[model samples]
Target: MTTRTAEMLMAVVMGLFSVFLMWKSAELEIGWIPDEGPGGGAWPFWLSAIMLLCCVVTLFRWWRRATPESRSTVQFMDKNTRRINYITVGSLVALLVLTHIIGIYFSIFLFLLFYIRFVGRHSWLLTGILSVASPVFLFFFFEAMLKILLPKGYSEPLFYPLYQIIY
Candidate 1:
């Protein structure tokens, strides 16, 4: 399909999804409560509402061919780009599946290692720094500061020392 057609189709799908989100969120009370700062659904409902508006505007622009995105008939991707896209998407899926086995931090580290070292052809030093540092930063940000625990899977014990130090 042409880019314009694909854009319209995606916009329509997103618009429908936004509407569904808004409807579901409204069931939990979309407005603010007198005592509470905001109802459980307030944030989601408002965000979905905004998305719906953007989708509507996109649809209108496409209909009018007002923007280059709306007017373009370009093919989305060539074979090489498509192959690269598929590889990237496959790696991300692998990362997600690995998360269930090795845990989020380790999965993220592996992903960064693969992307930076192999796909990006970066220097080993840079790849090593990013792959190690990102997970550590994430651990500190989520576990130490926010008190949020990410999935640790079979590697839960590995974080005990870090947790002991932080706590």
Candidate 2:
């Protein structure tokens, strides 16, 4: 489909999704509680409300052809772009599956390695640094500082020593 059509479609879909999010978030208290700074749903509800407003503006602009994207009739996705999108999506699915099998840290490591080195065509030094650093940072932030344990799957035993040190 054309860019204009795609833009309009996405705006409508996202608008609906925003509305859904707002409705769902509203199930929890959205306003401030006396003792608490903000209610559980305050952030999500407000964010969704803002997103809905943006979607409305997008739709209005599209109807008026006010934006360049609204006026453009360019094909939304050529073959190369479609292929890349598919590959990226497939990689993400793989990452999720691997998360269950290996764990979040290792899954993210593999994902970054593949995406950065192969898909992004970055230098090995940059890719290697990011691939290794991301998992380490996440481990410290979530497991050490936050005291929130992430799934380790088969790699659980491997972290015993590190956990002992941290705990």
Candidate 3:
């Protein structure tokens, strides 16, 4: 379909999704509690509200043909773009599957390695640095600092030594 059609469709779909999120979040308190800061649903509810507003603005602009994208009749995806989109989606699916089996850290490492080394055609040094550093940073940020344990799957035992150090 044309870019204009695609833009309008995405706006509508996202607007609906935002409304759904707002509804779900509103089931919990969206305002501040006396002892606690923001309520559990505050962030999600406000963010969804903003997203809905943005979607409304986008729809209005599209109706007026106020943006170049709204005016364009160009095809949304050429063959090369379609191929790239498929690859990205496939890679994401693989990441999720691998996360269930191998764990988030290793799966993310593999994902970053493939995307940086192959898809991005970056230098090996840069690729290696990023692939290693990203997972390490995530581990420290989530496990150490935030005290939130991400799924380790089959790789759970491997992190025992590090966990000992942290705890």
TM-score of each: 0.60, 0.58, 0.60
Superposed model 3: Cα runs more than 4 Å off: 1-73
lDDT of 2 by residue, 10-45 (tens): 999999999999999999999999987889999999
In model 2, the Cα lDDT at residue 158 comes to 91
Give all candidates' CA lDDT scores.
0.93, 0.96, 0.97
Top lDDT hit: 3
Off by over 4 Å in 2: 1-73
Return the lDDT, model 3, position 58.
98
Q: List the RMSD of every prediction in angstroms.
A: 5.4, 6.0, 6.4
What lDDT tens digits, residue by residue, belong to model 1 across residues 1-167?
A: 67898889989999999999999999997777998788999999999999999999999999999878778888867688888898899999999999999999999999999999999999999999999999999999999999999998999999889889999
**Candidate 1 vs 2: which has more lDDT:** 2
Worst 10 residues of 2 by lDDT: 149-158
What's the residue-level lDDT of 124 in candidate 3?
A: 96
Clash count, candidate 1? 0
